[model samples]
Target: MTYSPATQDQLLAIRVNAGIADLAASERFSAAEPDMVEAIVEGIGAFAAGEWAPLNRVGDLEGAKLENGVVRLPGGFAEAYADYVAQGWNAIAGPAEFGGQGLPFTLACNVLENLGTANMAFSLLPMLSVGAIEALEHHGSEAQKAAYLPKLVSGEWSGTMNLTEPQAGSDLGALRTAATPIESGEHAGKYRIAGQKIFITFGEHDLAENIIHLVLARLPDAPEGSRGISLFLVPKYHVNDDGSLGPKNDVRCVSLEHKLGINASPTCVMSYGDNGECIGELVGAENRGLMAMFTMMNNARINVGNQGVQIGERATQAALAYARERVQSARAGSPDKTPVAIIEHPDVRRMLLRMKALTEGARALLYYTAGQVDRGTLGDEAADRRGDVLVPLIKAWGTDVGVEVASLGVQVHGGMGFIEETGAAQHYRDVRIAPIYEGTNGIQAADLVMRKLGLENGAVFAALMADIARDATSDEPTLAALANDCAAVGEWMRDTASLDDRLAGSVPFCTMSAVAVAGWQLLRQLRAVESGEAPGLAAAKRASVRFFLDRLVAEAAGLKASAMAGAEPLYALTSEQLAG
Candidate 1:
């Protein structure tokens, strides 16, 4: 199926309904006029469809190759990346003082959705760069920002986050990378970083002139565990005093992993200071690397959530297209009649609607979260708190839905879906990593229940529930009921006596929260439709909301029950019994 970007009307409808347009118009984003935002969205959509979509298959087929410590991307990748940068797409939401266009992040989210939908693997390069940009913007020294921000914002030099190591995946406390302070010479006060970082996305890609790595390493004499870690700005090539590239640093791409999907994006094992000369400057204060890295990780979590929405949308579109063309047996009630397109089959229709409902629901929640991020910048403490609360939900639930929708897409294709030629399986493979990428969904759930719940002495979570409750009082009955159920679940979470109980049901609790939040967003969209917004799409919007409430929202109750079941039964099975 040919890819289709979200219509301008649809995008505007979401932005307006979510209040993102108003937020953009505020002092925090005075430069982001609605017309300009629309124009930018239109331009990015066109570029994504024209330049990026066609390369998805080629990237998957050819993948990336590693040779002589350098990584080579698939054909057309470099050209596409160059076009992406030259057009200033990379600077859409960047710091205005550092060569960025200074647009609202909401618009950036839309552009990212379009790009990710076109080609997830190819889209990852810029995605990681944005995270790196956020970290440096928040923590880098003035000199460091001046040296790297322009190139990074301009896309002349890409950026990466080097966190995961051979011995550490999610446990930053267990990392062993070393960063010794240099006391003399031109690089005095800098640290010589030496370590092996694995699973570094775009770590060694040849898409740009240079790559900036935000590495996490422990300083000598520092305390043990994550508190001792510090962030460093490590460049692949050393920079001269005049801002020109110098000799290669003691950093190399030791190898690339052969992954199940996203073959076009190189996942490298990076070696730093192998020869003991890889100099890096500190970002933020010393012995606070994990805190600094969290800035990037939080940003990345949201982008990864958007990836879920993007892949789900793409997969659903493809499935719908296939269903409309693939002929099968006659409709259930008319077996003697002529065979019709699979779309005519009730079951097939159900699957397609499931995909549509999940994809749109996820999109609504993600877009709303992006709006909260924009509002948070304006010193809206509530919005900032809300953004933090929603991060895990957006990442975990969105990606889980993305995976589920992609799987349903494959099911809709039947035997043909299993064939690589059909491309349905590729969506499944590509989306499979999102849940595990930023932080595993399991980790996201744990964070949601353990950490975020404690914010403001639980007042933050209560306010969230209150907001949903207020919205649930709408005339729509199902929406109201779902909202009430969500509130009840929240109450149970608050009253639960044991952390073990919460942990036991953390995943389900997160899922229930996600469904309830998506339902709230859908309710808002339905109201917008009733008010004649996107008149032509109103009927479809209503159907989607109904489908979501009836089909998906019903799962919330069962999830709540499972959450309340506690950890006893979960631990009932011993290791040997589980193996049996």
Candidate 2:
């Protein structure tokens, strides 16, 4: 089955409901028109389905090769990337001053979903660059911005985030990378960095002229732990005073990781200053690298969530197509006794609905989070807070759902899914990394319960719950019951006394919160349907909402119960007993 992008009607509803239409009218996106936005989305979707989708399986089969010191992508990847750059898709949500289209970030989310659905591994090359562009735009020096933004924004060069080391995965405090102050020469006051960073995505690729690495290292006299770390702009090739590239910097891709999925995107073990000449300029202030890196990390977290949505959407489409065409057992009530499509089976229908509901729900939450990002940039402080609060939930829940839906997609395919030829297993493998990387889902849950809960002394979370409660109400009894369940769970979380109790239940709480938000968004979409917009798609939307409320929302009570269970039972088991 050919991959299909979201329908124009679906995109339009998201635009309207998320307030992106008004956002497009702002001076930042003043050049944008409704027709133009529609055209851009359609064009990109077409390019993705036609050019990129065909390469997904090929990418999986070919993977990426480390030829000598350089990384080479699978067939068609470089060409597709060039086409993507030439079409100006890279600049969709980039800074306008740097030659970007400066459209709303929400629109960028739509573009990412389409691209990611077509081919996830291919999509990752540009995805990491988006985070790099964000970091440079927010924290890079004026000179650094002038030197890098245009090319990175134009997709002539790609980017990477180098935070992981062999010894320091999630613990930034344990990083041993060193950055010593350099003296004399054109690069004085800059630091010469020497370190090894592992799991660096798109660290070295032939598709771009140069790779810009946002690296984290520590100064010689810096204090211990994460507090002393600093962010640096380290380019693969040195930039001259006149904006032209100079000789290659002292960085090399020592090796590439053999992964279960996303094989076309090279995960490299990068060595910096091995011969002692890798120069890097400090970004932001000294001992404040974590703060600066957060800019990129936050951007990446959202995009990661979109990855989940994309994979889920692709899996669902593939499963539905197969179910429709693959005839199976005879229907229970068939007088003719002829076999029917598997979709006719009640259990099969239930599985498809589960896939549909989860995919749609994830898209709603992700798009809503993207809209908040745009609002935070163009609107007030509250919008910024809302964006901050939703990032972890979106990243964790969206990805978890992505994995779940993709697994269901495989289940729908049955024997064929396990065989790999049907392509269902690839979706499952590709998405498994999402919940593990960009801050594991466990870490995200911890962030939600521990850090985000205290935002504005809890007013922010309270406001979010209030919004969910308000939108969750409906004349339909099922909807009303779901809303009450969500509200009751929210109250329990708010009133929970033990921090350990909250920690133990953090994952479930995050899941419960995401389902409620998704339920609320779908409810709003249903209201739009009642107003006679996109009547053709309304039935599917109604069914998805119904399935979400009946099946997924029903889990909220159990999640709440688990959340209230505290950490005592969790610790009751001895370490040896648990291991056994």
Candidate 3:
């Protein structure tokens, strides 16, 4: 399906119910006065079809070429990027007071997913910029905002987060980047940032006039480890007061690394202050770099989750296309004279269903989380309370599906999926980083367990469970069946304890939580579809949810078993035992 248009009657139903409509409705949700949803929809659709969609294959096939110390993107990127900017897409969810469209993130999430689905590599620049925007907006001085926000929002320039160094993989505590105060003269109060950042996405690029780097640096008297780190806005090229560009900053893109996927996006190794004059203005208070970066990290993590959803959707579309055209052996009951489309085979259908179910389910989960974020942003105090509880859960659970669902896509494509030419392999390659980057899935799990689990002293989770139970008690057999599964899984999680147990089984726990939460989201989506008796959409929602709970919900048993298997046994085992 090209674009699923929500009928006017359905829109009216949303107005009547006055409930949530997922993150993509952030603009609709936030606008105090009603406006045309079609405008946002048409705007995003045009960007997707005209700009982003046409670039995916080109990016994958052409990739990025490393020449001399710079990475050159495919030929059409700059033009497509210009188109995106011209359409005002970069500022779609930006602050209106600062030249943005003044829309909420949920609306941005919708646009972002389509971009990712079309071209993830190209889409990543804006994703990182979003994080940079959040950091600067929340923590940057008013002067800094005035200097940078307009350019960044207007897409005249791009932004990136710079935290990882050579030694700092997942562990930020090991960061060796340092920022020493300037001794004297022209640049007073500023610091010289001297460090090498690895795996810096969009660290250096030609798409924008300048790249604003949000660098984490340590002051001269700063302590060791993460505590001493501080945030700084170090631009690649200094900006003149008239909004003109000036001298290049001390920072430079030393080189770009060859990667398995997202080749269209430049991942660079950058060295700041090699000339002993890389100027950086500190953000917020001293020793608050990590705190500031976390906002970007948190936002990017959720966006990455959406990236996963987008990839899964793309793969599903590709696989469906392949299955329809590729002929294979006939099924047992079919006539033996001629071959049939692979989709006609039971196994192929099963795989397609699995992919469809997983992709749809993931979309629902991520979209619901975005809805929660919007609710927190625009909804009153009572609604904000619940949104607060869902953030980490959204981040953790959403990313897990990206990896899992993409893998399912690969499986459906069979051996052809392994080859790069088919494009299916690229989805798998790109998605591999989702779980690892933006704070590894492990860290997401740890956050969910430590922070989210205790939100409102766990009353929030408890209330959600109670609501599930209430729904299950209804005369509707389908919901009653769902309630049974929900109760079983909830009990398992509630009864479990110990970080060892949690860690040992964290991946599975993440998946299970994703399934349950997504099921809940599907129910809401079904309600949205059903409110106006949009049967096809409602049927699709029900089928997707049923497929998940029936086939995937049982995986909770495995998760529970693993969660209960504390690290004690593994720790107690001798090295010899591990060797065996």
TM-score of 3: 0.90
lDDT of each: 0.87, 0.85, 0.72
lDDT of 3 by residue, 1-580 (tens): 2322223322332332223344334554455234544466556656776667777777877777667655678877889888888888888778777899766666577677778877788889999988888889889999899999998888888999998888778788788888888778877888888989999898887788889999988888788888998999999888887878889899888887888778888889999988988999999888999999988887787789888777777777778887898887776696575888888888878777777777776676665566556666665554555555455555666656666667766776788878777778878888777777788778877665566555676666556545655654453344444445444444445466665665665565555555666665555555666675555566665676567656765554345556556678777868998888
lDDT sort, best first? 1, 2, 3
Best by lDDT: 1
- Write candidate 2's Cα lDDT for 298-410 as tens digits: 98999899888899989999999999999988988888689999999999999999989888888888878887888788866797898898899889999998999999999
What does the lDDT read for residue 257 in candidate 1? 92
TM-score of 2: 0.97
Please, what are the lDDT tens digits per residue for candidate 1 over residues 39-90?
A: 8878888999999999999898899999877799877889999999999999
Index of the highest-TM-score prediction: 1
User: Which stretches in model 2 have alpha-carbon errors above 4 Å?
Assistant: 476-496
TM-score of each: 0.98, 0.97, 0.90
**TM-score-best of 2 and 3:** 2
Predictions ranked by TM-score, top down? 1, 2, 3
